[model samples]
Structures are given as structure tokens and as C-alpha cells.
Target: MSQSETPSLYASRVPVFPRRVDGFFRRMKWWIMIVTLGIYYLTPWIRWDRGPDLPNQAVLLDLANRRFYFFWIEIWPHEFYFVAGLLVMAGLGLFLFTSALGRVWCGYTCPQTVWTDLFILTERWIDGDRNARVRLWKAPWSLKKARLRLTKYVVWALIGLATGGAWVFYFADAPTLLVDLVTGQAHPVAYTTMAILTFTTVFMGGIAREQVCIYACPWPRIQAAMMDEDTITIGYRDWRGEPRGKHRKAEGSDNLGDCIDCNACVNVCPMGIDIRDGQQLECITCGLCIDACDDVMAKIGKPRGLIDYFALQDEAAERAGAPPTQIWRHIFRPRTIVYTSLWSLVGVALVVALFVRPELELTVAAVRNPTYVTLSDGTVRNAYEVRLRNKHGDERPFRITLTGDPALRVTLEGTPYEAVSVPAQEMVLQRVYVTAPPGSDPAEGARTEFRFWVTDMTNGERAHQDTHFVGRGED
Candidate 1:
């Protein structure tokens, strides 16, 4: 092929200026944005009384201490499975919603959509709505353009900084961290994390905008597999809208649908794709186009629903002059039932595990260096490192015992058996020694198994670990 015949590899981005529209769906988006942003920014500041010995931040990931606190629940490092289970349930929940409602998460709850909506609102306020913004983009740089651009970018940067700053509060005490940050005494990691998050939030929310949803987010591509014919999504009724022309019905044009070809749907779309083109991955199913078209239809005296929430099967039925399917039937189908059941089961299991899990844990590791020694008294001796955890809010006493060998006795660092005092919600590490009388363990060179048990003295709850007692060989 000649040089001119080959297409260029790069495609320049086309800017999308979504015109402002008001109706039910637009109001819903506004409420969702306010509620979600409130939760994200305010949750770290809420206080919980976890007693004087524990951190009071309601939602905290205490990484240095390897503990997670969420209101009344505290998760130690050993209980990470609870976190994993919650994540699994979250994924299943996404599947359930997508299978039933179609792109609802992307439309209403996605961080990208929420932040992009926020950035666009700021842009519209500063630079003027759709037509003015488009004109400004096409116009060459000037003092007015420079001023608007500068102001808009500064505001976006501030929002990004706030988003990043709010995130760090989840890892530390919010009040203390705020003071340290203002005084420039916070840890370097805090600054580094905030910087990285700020950069991403600004780029993804303000500059990238819809490009992140179109090219970066995998949900739009993956959602197709989850949606079926019965799944409801925002759609253009081409059967009732096509054969497009301007005021075709007023002109008494034959075989023409109700559509006036005014382009209101395309004008209000954030993704810059025509919804009439049908089921593109770029569409977030935001339903802004529905709001826009509905207003236009109401003014033009045509029955509403030129664009509306419609299942794929309902489209065919409507095209064939049949009534559309009921919305509830669309929601409670077999696929959605299965997904909902799986999600609910995972949530229930996590709740049960949280209630029934033991409050104390014990671990024992046999010392491997030289394995065992034969005392001068002809007894077999083995060493171990014992760790005990007290999960309660107050300090507790525990007694350690040895079992599995009648002739075996346990001691702590050569002292007689005594109760180990473990600090509240803390672990105690100590050295332990186990000795067995001569001929009690096994024949020379053999190993005998035993148990190290720690019983909480207050409640009599016990946690035990299995270990082996090693004996020396004799020639």
C-alpha cells in the first residue's frame, strides 16, 4: 500500500460536552453523588468507644498493628478471611445487579461516574454549558480562555487533594493525622500516598473524564456477559423512533415515527455516542438521554418513551405491536435469583463466623537447632517458642499445660508452671521447655507428639497446639 493509503495508528480524542438536562434520572444522580461523597469523606471521623486500650476511630485499617476496626467488629491479621468473604459477596452483588438491572452500578455508584459528574459540573459552572464550552474549545487561546481554564484546573486540583487526604485518614487517627498534616509533621508515607492518589484522582476525574469509562474500565466490557435478553437497560426505541426527519408528523409525512430527529438524546450523553445506535459499550445507561427525550416528547405532545428503560425482549415485543413485559418479572428471574442467593449466603456465613469465632488463640513452634538434648539425668528435653494472644478488651491470665505424654512436664524458661499474663488485645511471646523422663518419649532417635494447651483462667476457654518432642539417639 502507498503511504497515503495506510491509516494512522493514533486517533485524537473528541471532546464530549454533555448538555445539562433535568428530570427524574438527573435528580437521582445528584442525590447519589451527595450521599456517596458524604460517606467517603465523613466515615473516618466517626468515633467508636472501643475502650481506653483500643483505637476509637470507627473505620480504621491499623496497618502498623495489623488490626481492622469497623464499628463494633475488630479483625486481627488471622481473621483476614472475613475480609476476603466480604469481597466475594461484593462481586456476586455486582453480578446480581447487572443481571437484573443492567449497568446500574456504572450509572449511579461507580467512582469514575461520580467523580466525572462532579468535574463536569464544575466545568459547566465555570466555562458555561455545552454550546459555550464547545465554542471555547474551538476558539484560539485568549485571556478569557486562559482565566477559565486556570480557575477550573485549580478547583479540580483542590478536589483531588481533598479526596486523597480523606483516604489517608482511614489508616490513622483522623484528628491526630489532621494536626500532623497541618503542622508538616506527618510521616513521609502519608505524603507519598496522598500525592499518588491526588494525581490519579485529578487525571481520571477531570482530564480523562469519559475516556476512563470507555477505554480504562473493564466493567463495560464484562457487563455484556452478565446481561441477558430479560435484563432492563436504558434504550432508544428505534422501532418507534426511526425513519428520522424533522417535524415529519406535523408535515403529515407517511410511514414516519414520532421522532422529530432533534438529537436531544445524543446531546445529553456523557459518552458522546448516540443511544439510537444501540447497546454500545460506551453507554453507562445513565438515563440522562431518557430524561432529555422525555422532556422533549412532553413538549412536542407525543407520548413519552422514545428512550426508556426496556429489556431486549420487550423491544421485539413492542416492535411486533405487543405489550411490554412487567418490570418485576425482569427483576426476579432465575439467573438473578441464583446470584442473589450466593451473595446472601456469603454474607450470612461471614456474620456467623464473626459471632462464633474464638476470642483467644495459641501457637507453638518447636526449636529446631540441635533438635533435642539428653540431660545428664538421662531425660529428653526439647525447646519451643510459644505465642499467646488475648483478644478481649482487658488483660487476661492463662495457664499453659502439657499433654500427650504422661511422663512429660512443661516449664517456662526453667521456672515452674505459672499463669501467663497477656495484655489486652495483645500477643505474648515466650520461650518454653518440655522434658520427658528417660524411656518416656520413645526409643532412642524416635519422636513423640504432644500438645501445648493454654486455658483462659477467667472463662476456662482453651486453645491448644500440637508439637513433637524429640529425643537423642544413643549408639
Candidate 2:
């Protein structure tokens, strides 16, 4: 191909200036934004009294201590299954919502969507509405434009800083960290994390905006697999609004469809796609188009729902002059039911595990380098490492004993007592020795299965770990 005929791989993005529209869905978006942002910013500050030994923060990751605390619930490092269960539940929930409502997550509660909406609101307040913004964009550089741009950028940066600041609080005590941060006494990692998050938040939510949804986010593309003919998604009723024209009183005005081709839906779309063109990948299904179209329909004395939430199945029935399928039937289909069931199952399992777990935990590992040693007295001896974990707020003594064989005796290294005191909310590692007297059944056998029982002296709570006691024949 000639140089002029060559196609460029990169195309500059056309900036989108979504006009403000007010209706049910827009109000819903405002409420959702307030609630989600409120939760994210305020959760780390909530206090929960977890005694003197543990953190009092209601929600904390406690990365340094390898623990996660949420109000009354505490998850230790070894109990990572709880975190995994929560992640699985999140995934299932996304699938469930996508299968039922089609990208509602992206349209409303997603961090990108919420933050972008906030940035847009800030922009609109500073630079005026859609027409004004367009004029400003086309005009050359000036003092007034520069001032407005600088002010908008400063506000966006502050918002980004707050977002990053709130995130770091999740991993540490919010009040203490805030003081340290202000005083420049916080850790370097904390500062580094905050800086990175701030930059990303500003770039993605403010500058990138709808481009992030189109190019960065995978959800818009992946949502197709989750949705089916029964899924209710934002769409235009081309059958009702076809043969669109601006002239309402032309020669064939009676034959013209209800659509006035005013471009109201396109103007209000955050993703900058014409919904009347049919289902496009760029559409976030934010329902702003529905609001815009409904307003126009009301003004023109036409029925509403020119652009609305509907399923493919509903389209066929509506075109055939029949009532559309009920909304409940679309949401309660098989795919969504399975996703909801899995999500609930994981949630229930996590809750059950949290309640049933023992406050005292025990783990035993046999020393393998020299598994079995034959003493001068011809007795079989096995060395093992025992870890005792005390989840309680107070320190407690734990008594260790051998459960399977009466002939086997257990002793703690460097101490003569069978019971050891473990610190509160801590794990203590103790070297243990198991011995079988000469000519005992365990001493002569190749291996004897045994259990190490650790009993809490204070509350009588017991935890046990099963292992094999290697004998002389194993060598």
C-alpha cells in the first residue's frame, strides 16, 4: 500500500463530555455512589474492642502480624481459607449480577464508575455543562481556561490523595497512621503505596474516564458470556423508534417512528456511544439513556420506554404485540440461581468455620533428619516440633500429652513440666521428645501412628494433631 493509504494502528481517543440528566436511574447512581464511597472511606475508622492484646480497629488487614480482623471476627495466618472464601463469593456475586442485570456492577458500584462519576461532577461544576465544555475544549489557551483547568486538577488530585489515604488505613490503625503520615513518620512502604494509588486513581478516574471502561476493564467483553437471551440489559427499541428523523411534521410525518433523532441518549451516555445503534461493547448499561429518552418521549406525547431495560425474549414478544416477560423471571433464571447458590454456600461455610474453630490450636511435625534414635538403654526416641497457638486474649498454659500409645512418654525439651504457658494471641514453638521403653510395641514396630493432644489448662479447650512415631525398623 502507498504511504497515504497506510492505516495507523493507533487512533487518538475522542473525549466524551456526558451531559447531566436527572431521573430515577441517575438518582439511584447518586445514592449508590454516596453509600459505596462512604463505606470505603469510613470503615477503617470504626472501632471494635478486641481486648488489650489485639487491635481495636473494626476492620484491619494487620499485614505485619499476618492477621485479618473484622469487628468481632479474627482470622489468623493459618486460617487463610476465610479470605479465599470471601474472594470466591465476590466472583460468584459478580457473575450472578451480570447474568441477571448485565453490567450493572460496571455501571454503578464499580470503583472506576463511582470515581469517574465524581470526577465528572467536579469537571461539570468547574467547566460548565456539555456545550460549555465543548466550547472550552475547542478554544485556544487562555488565562481563564488555564485557571479553571488548574483548579479542576488540584481538586482531582485531592480526591485521589484521599482515596489512597483511605486504602492504607485498612492495613493499619487509621488514627495512628494518619498522625504518622502527617508528621512524616510513617513507613516508606506506606508512602510509596499511597503515591502509586493516588496517581492511578487520578489517571484512571479523571483523565482516562470512559476509556478505562472501554480499553482497560475486561468486564465489558466478559459480560457477554454471563448474559443470555433472558438477561435484562439497557437497549433501544428500534422497532418503536426506527426511521428516525428530526422533522416531526414532514410530508410523511404520520409514517415516521416515535424517535425525533434529537441525540439526547448519545449526549447523556458516559461511554459516548449511541444506544439506538444497538448493543455496543462501549455501552456500560448505566440507564442514563433511558432517562434521556423517557424525558423526550414525555415531551413529545409518546409512550415512554423508547430506550429501556429489556431482554431479547421480551423484544420478540413486544414486537408481536404481546406483553413483555416479567422482570422477576429474567433475574431468577438457572445461570443466576447457580451463581447465587454458590455465593451463599461459600458465605455460609465461612461463617460456620469462623464459629466452630477452636481458640486453641496445635500442630506437630516430626524431626526427619534423624527420625528415630536408639538410646544406650535400647529405647526408641523420636524428636518433634510442637506449635501451640493461643487465640484467646489472655495467656494460657497448655498441657501436651501422647494419645495413641500408653507406653510412649512425652517430654518438653529444656523443661521438666508437661505444660507450657503460651502468650496471648501468639504461637509458641517447643521441642518435644517421644520415647518408647525397650521391647515396647512402638519400639519394635516400623512405625506407630500417634496423636499429640494440647489441652488448654484455663478453659479445657483441646486441639490435637496426628502423626507417625518412627521406629527403629524405619532405618
Model 1, span 207-289: residue lDDT tens: 89899998888898899999999999988898888787786546656667777889999999998989988889999999999
Candidate 2 lDDT tens digits, 328-354? 999997888899899999999998998
lDDT of 2: 0.93
The most accurate candidate by lDDT is 2
Per-residue error (Å), model 2, residue 359:
1.5
Where does candidate 2 stray beyond 4 Å?
A: 1-4
- Name the TM-score of candidate 1: 0.95
What TM-score does prediction 2 earn? Answer: 0.96
The positional error of residue 171 in candidate 1, measured at the CA in angstroms, is 1.0
Best by the TM-score measure: 2
